[model samples]
Target: MATLEELRKQLDTIDDQIVHLYEERMRVCEAVGEYKVQSGKKVYDQTREKAKLADVASKVSGEFNKKGVQELYEQLMSMSRKLQYRQLVQAGALGRLPFIEVDSLEKETARVVFQGTEGAYGQAAMKHYFGENCNCFHVHTFRDAMEAIEDGAADYAVLPIENSSAGSVVEMYDLLEEFENYIVGETIIPITHTLSGLPGAKLTDLKKIYSKGIALMQASHFLDEHADWQKISVVNTAVAAKKVLEENDPTQAAVCSAYAAQVYGLEVLADHINNEKDNYTRFIIVTNQKIFLKKATKISICFELPHESGSLYRILSHFIYNDLNMSRIESRPMEGKSWEYRFFVDFEGNLANPAVKNAIRGLREEARNLKILGNY
Candidate 1:
């Protein structure tokens, strides 16, 4: 029944009191952080947080209010944990990460490996990252490339991770989880697919078209035009070109890069056959060593979340509270767990930064099986 102005003043007074109490609460949390630092205790205590939420909910009225109070406390507790983490970082109590920091990759003496034949996009990415004249070899499959680095047969391996038009190269993500190899760097190359065949072969003479599965999908517009042409998926585009050249059949053509066609001595019958003109593919450079470049600005990590509401959001809040910018996130099914998934996230931060360490520490405690894939 009070006037609108009187009601607004009452709300303002409550807000001021709430701010004062919030600062007082933070001061108490700081004291707790100091005690934990001296006692070697962890910042995140899941059991304590569960109990605190229950206690707060009991003090509130109605189902909606109970839920609201629980959510509010969850955020307040998360902020408290973050503050403690920052204190630990400042006190040098946060342990060193497993990754070693290096001034530069040993490009001069490092042996590189790539998937498929000589002219695959992986080879182009390798040349661009490691240098054109770097020592390198080819592997038959992506698994083979991963193994080459895992077994120390090669110091590094170049593999395609994603495509602009076709989306993620899913097998690569699975392979990353399956292997111990870590990414050290990345390179993106513009993709320009061409239809090529024997020196004298014409587009009209093509009976079958061959390329990698993703390549065929990317050039769907051009392939759809030649509906009569049978499409075959190979291990790599370069391999397709090699197949066409070795068959000596004018009826068979390949969808590949101009460089690949030239490598296999095939003549281009059609150029730029991809559906998107500005297509590109991102490639990752992986190695067996758990080391990161001193100047690396990006970090890739993967983790499995508990099957609870807001789990992903809670995990991601670490990045927000630490002021880290996440650039990409992708999820893949956990190998044996149906419906549940594992998440891969790419964020902007170097492992050496204090804020980066603080976020990672909080994530390690809250997320299950959190793995730092790389920092590059």
Candidate 2:
């Protein structure tokens, strides 16, 4: 009903108004961020957003629809929450209010290394944790990621530790022991493994499937469901999708994120093909820097206990004695120790505190091979 010129002009006008609204919103958001900082309240508030959405929805009527208004306001509220979170996080220690000087970022920005290909979860984690302004080089193996950091070829390395459906990455834990680095932060990403194949490929035509190691493990139920298809495991989930593109084989498909399907130019044969729908992977951001977390956040440490009776109990007693809660504890068999085991633990409290420091000392006296993984 309208000419292209008229449509373009209307869009330009709307864009200008949108930009003005965004600027105004940010002005208020900045003040809210300051208020939150002063009050020591969290930046994100779901209840506040729900109330806002309901208030906005109540005002709309007629053709606009109440549900539509609620949905639109909910999205806007989500953006507001994110903006506030970023503001608080940026204001806390990095941008302004210099609690800790991270001036070494530029000095140490030689190179960044990560595990897997461009669209892998590790790449996303690296970008999410270290900011997305720079290019990151990816390695094929987790060991190579550690080796790069160890050999000074890379300033930082990203590795995946655990997944929701499949649980802990035993290989990554061992690699952490073999190669040491400080975990600067931790991130959890929701996994959405998509089954994709070459263009025009149909589900019945699929003979073989490709997926990353973690995805393969997560989607083991898929293998069981489709017992006829041969499985090929790759280094990255997105790489598997990309391999389908490169190979141009209609008979084979790759399991990866639905987002990767579009990224790699593959068509999705199945979405959320993981064994469980709500699969998520938790990755620790390992860096050489000794970064600190917020008050409520916990720090991780790796240690080992001898094969004596109550050795684990004696080490845990130190945590109990100090009234420190252990968030997580994992054990793996130590190399060359037939019955002995290594313990990886995560506990609340900063290691900078005297009590936590003494607790580590007590743990050191008890643990056979105790390593402070990171302060946060």
Candidate 3:
């Protein structure tokens, strides 16, 4: 056998040749991209890729080598497609995104809507985003708030999307998919829960507690101490305080914000009762118009992948190839499809960025029903 040094030199020579051939292949692929661009052809050709993979596998030796070559070619083909997408963008053939870029939201004359009654967290978020004196109204349900924007009854709607200690507001995610309204902005508010009741009521007099479901969960540690107290879920925490005040029953108390208790004319029996002291909730401002602010730095999108192994990985690779940073991802069950899910992803990129366009274009070709939920 040859010495170890000689064997290493042989492998290095082969590697150098491989790199040279790879570069030659990429040059050919670039020419193909130019040809397709002029011919008005799409970048992704699934049939051609499948045939090429089969041919590459046939040229390899063992089963493992065949699989390895297939995987390698898959990545190479993916890179070629991405290069073509970038070329399309350079040629201005990628087309304009549907969302219009605006200097800023029309906060002065815009009518905003929120879910639940006054003094609710949604109201707080609305005030923080649109301004305290902005023209706004309350709706009974989240769906109603979405409809208010969809039907043009309101220019925008404020809704809670996620909470820090608890998790995502699931209903809000569903409503986002169901409606055409797009998120324009977001705000984070610190959540401080309090146990409040009638003016003279005491903690010992509490028999039942009322608050939003997620609010009750957030205050689980405090509620666990009062195991005998029945926890009731309502539409909103502020509404719960209003309920406690209207009932006039010392046995009923509410888990709500201190401001809400004061708004509903109730007295706080215990303050800062939430499990997490530094809890915060993120709220999104949505509008019917397909527009995004010029300074927006985040984009949210949803897509369904084919129920096949590596499908999701392939879809996500576009983000990696484009060097886009994905901030968050959540999956929801696709309605009427058992075990199939729709993925929602939040990434750090504006609508006008070429990388964003390339990644989105690749995802649109590979994934099903890819929707740009918002760019904010």
lDDT of 3 by residue, 285-314 (tens): 999899999999999999998888888888
lDDT of each: 0.93, 0.73, 0.92
TM-score, ranked from best to worst: 1, 3, 2
Please identify which of the two predictions, 2 or 3, would achieve the higher lDDT against the true structure.
Answer: 3
CA lDDT, candidate 3, residue 176: 88
lDDT of 1 by residue, 10-59 (tens): 99999999999999999999999999999989898999999999999999
Clashes of 3: 0
The parts of candidate 2 lying over 4 Å away from their true place are 1-110, 290-296
TM-scores, one per candidate? 0.98, 0.68, 0.97
Q: In model 2, what are the clashing residue pairs, if there are any?
A: 194-256
lDDT against true structure, model 2: 0.73
Task: Tell me the spans in candidate 3 whose CA falls farther than 4 Å from its real position.
Answer: 1-6
